[model samples]
Target: MLVYLRLLKESLSFAINALRNNKLRTLLSLLGVTIGIFSIIAVLAAVDSLDRKISKDLSSLDKNTIYLMKYCFGPSEIPQWKREQFPNVKYDEYISLKNSLTNTDQVAYQFFVNKETIKYDSKTVSDVNIVPASNEIVEIEGLNVDNGRFYTESESNSGTAVIVLGYDIAEGLFGGSEPVGKSIRLYGQRFTVIGVIAKQGAGFFGDSNDTSVYIPTNFLRRMYGDNDAMTPVIVLKPVKGVDMDAYKAQVAQKLRAIRGMKAGEMDNFFINVLSGFTDFIDGILGQMNVVGWVISGFSLLVGGFGIANIMFVSVKERTNLIGIQKSLGAKNRFILFQFLFEAVILSVIGGIIGLLLVWGISLALTQLLDFEFVLSLGNILLGTGISAIIGLISGILPAISAANLDPVEAIRTGM
Candidate 1:
């Protein structure tokens, strides 16, 4: 072990000297490895960051939460024309499910409506997301109220002219003043502000609650009279510890019965589960990973070739030294390991530089974009491991040739 440690030290020193003496050559040879490591690590870091953001955005909601809607969230066997023909989930269905579904924790009715402008005196905020939802949405979505409270079930059922403001919307319209009890105008009607949502930062999707205002779904129904353009969904949260498949089946059966579907007729509505959406995201991330690997693999191949070529040249240049060392009783294993270690050290240096570059850029991006760009420890380890493997594969043949050289023949050839 002591001898091997000494050999490693010598090999590292030799590698450093080679780099210093042949600066341009060494740089050119290592560039491929540096770029390769940078590409792979950067891609991995980006994907990891995206995954984290999605997880953070969805963390508050139960993965078992289900959305019953006319449209599917993911790819579906149902044709687009047929999907378009499916009737929108009505407020009545929401009420029926809320009262009838026994295996549920919470049920919510929500509407997807056109963007509307909101006004407070002279200050107007345009293109704000207007959410018309039942009072139960507050509990289903796990929303936090920074001030005031969400509208009650009575207010929702009565279609009262009351509104709940998101953090940004409240700040924009009311600034630092007390927004609760203040009135805001929407659709040419005045609505008294009843609550304000807590600040929720940027979301993975553009649907963060910060820029939204919520009112009773019945209010929209009353205003528009069941407009065809407005899409309504019934969101369900299943009871904890319940068999999800059984629960979904039960929900489906109930819906089918409520909708009056015949025994053999197909169900019109699509059931989109939160977990399925997450699985879809995972599939997309997996594809991105595969693409990153394929593109970066070419650069790594070139890097390996460059290292191999340099190692062979180094062997040729040091034939006489190898012969002398062999004559002095150095073993073949020592000679092989010496060269192998040198190659690995060189590759690792390049990989480290690449990793540092990635870290710096990631930090810059996080600051510039206000989105966290993560560089996990696992990815760093993966980069280092890949570099070492490349070095070993590239240096093997040259190391073996050097180790197997006949002392007299090597000396004669070098002279």
Candidate 2:
């Protein structure tokens, strides 16, 4: 073991000397590897960060939750015109489903309404998201209340003039003062602030919980009377361990009977399952990863050739030293290991530089952009493993060639 360690130390010394002696050749060789590592790792890190952000944004809601609406989230057989012609999900259907739907944890009705301006005294905040939803949305969405409480079912059923403020909206209107129990004007009417939601950072989309205000769905219904612009949707959160296929089928059958659709006729509404949407997104991200690998693989291929070329040149330059070592009882394996060590050292150096670049860029992007960029330990290990593999593959042929050289012939050629 001690003898092997001494051999390894010598091989390392030779590897460093080769790199130091050939500055221009070493830089050119390292460039290809560095670029390859950078391209691959950067793409992977970016995609991973995006995926994490998506997961974080959606963490509160159940993936099995279903949205009953006129439109579908994924590709559908139904045409655009047919989807458009389909009637909007009604408040009555939401009520019916809530009471009658089996294997359901909770159900909610929400309106996709236009942005509204909120006013408290002289302070005015515009382009605020107006989420008029049923009280059950609190549980369905797993909303966290920092102050006061969410509106009760009675207030929602009665269409009371009560509102829940988002973190930013509350901060903007009241500043240091308490926002709960205060009256705010929205849609030219005063609403009592019932609760304030906990602070949530930026969402995957521009619209965040921090910039939204929740009101009772019935309040908007009494005023607008099922306006198409409001686009009512029924959200269903199924109980855990329920058979999703049967549950969705049961829902379709019930809705079909309610709408009085004839036999063999297709259901007008779409059942947009959250799990299906996430699966579709996962497919897209997987394709992106494949593309990144293919593109970066070309750079790595070039880098491998560069490393092989440098290794072969190093072997030729050290022919005299190799012959002397062999004459002094050095083994063929030592000659092979020497070149392999050099190749690996160069590749690893390039990879380390690439990793450093990625780390610096990740920090800058996280600070500058709204989205956070993470370089995970798994990815770092993956990058390092990839680098070392590239080294072994590139060094093998040259290492073998060095090992097989005739000591006397090599010494004469070098002289």
Candidate 3:
């Protein structure tokens, strides 16, 4: 054990001395390693940050809730006429479906109409997202009111011209003044503000929840003067104490009945739970990960070759020294180990610098570019491991050449 430790210490000392002796060559070799490791770490940090943002955004939707829509989230290949076939599902249909479902505690239906500029006096806000939703949206969607209150079921049934403002919208229109009970004009019609939603921040796609406005579905329909049923996106939550799986089955059965679909026939409406959406997103990220590694692996391979060439040059320059060491009774294995140790040291230092660079870039992105930064243990390990492997392999040929040198001939030629 002591002999092994001594050998390791000697190898490190020798490697250090060699690095110090060849200042320019060492810098250039380390630069290659730095570039390779920088690529890996930068890619990994970006992927980690992207994954985190995506997971956070997806998780924003309720786990037990399902979306009832006319189209699938995975693809845009749905026939255009299919949406026309439904036109709009009636509000009465929602009550009928809710009554039929014994396992569901709450169900909310929502849809959006074409956006119109909201005007308050001379101030105008055009970037507002307007959603028409049922009263159950307050419960099923886990909404919190920042001021006033959400519109009542009675109000929705009567098609009351009431609006609920999101935090950003409220601030933009009211300028920190109380907006509840005030009037705002949308689509040439005046609507009274009843509530302001708490801030929900931004999703991964940069969609801001606070920039939205909500109102009764009936009010939205009335604004269009269309009794035609709009395709409602229904969100349902299971009753407390009911087993989720059983509730899902019961809800499915009830929805099929309401849609008047016979058994074995596909239902017209789509139901999307957490699993399908998460799986779809994960599959995309998985493909990205594979592609990123394949590209970065090529960069690492090229960098390894650069290190090998530099080491070869170094070995040739130190031929006389190697011969002297051999003449002083150094073993072939000792000479090989010294060169290998130097290569590993160089690679590791470059890797550390690369990691630091990545961290700096991540900080800059978060502070200046509004991107989230994430660092993971897995990525760190991957970068370090790849760098070490590059060093070991790159050192092989040079190490072997140094080990196999003819000491007498080397001394005679001063090589």
Winning candidate number (lDDT):
1
Backbone clashes in each candidate structure, one number apiece? 0, 0, 3
State in Å the error of residue 283, model 1. Answer: 1.0
Model 3 lDDT on a 0 to 1 scale: 0.77
Query: What's the C-alpha lDDT at position 232 in model 2?
Result: 86
Stretches > 4 Å off in candidate 2: none
Error (Å) of candidate 1 at residue 68 is 0.5
Local accuracy of candidate 2 as per-residue lDDT tens digits, 263-366 = 99978999999999989988988888999899889988999999999999988988988898888988999888878877888888878888889999999989
How do these models rank on TM-score, best leading? 2, 1, 3
Q: Provide TM-scores for the models.
A: 0.96, 0.97, 0.85
- State candidate 3's TM-score: 0.85
Instruction: Identify the runs in model 1 with alpha carbons over 4 angstroms from their true place.
Output: none
1 or 3: which has the higher lDDT? Answer: 1
Superposition error at 33 for model 1 (Å): 1.7
lDDT of each residue in 1-415, candidate 3, tens digit only: 7855777687677667767887777767777677777877787688778878877655545566777666666664557677446434555567777777776768877875556679999899996788888888888766779899999999877779999998888888999788999999986889999999888766676555588888888776666654344456777777656677787677667767776779897556666776677777778877777777777777677778877887798788778888998999989998888888777766777777778788888888898867778767877887788788888999999999999999997676673
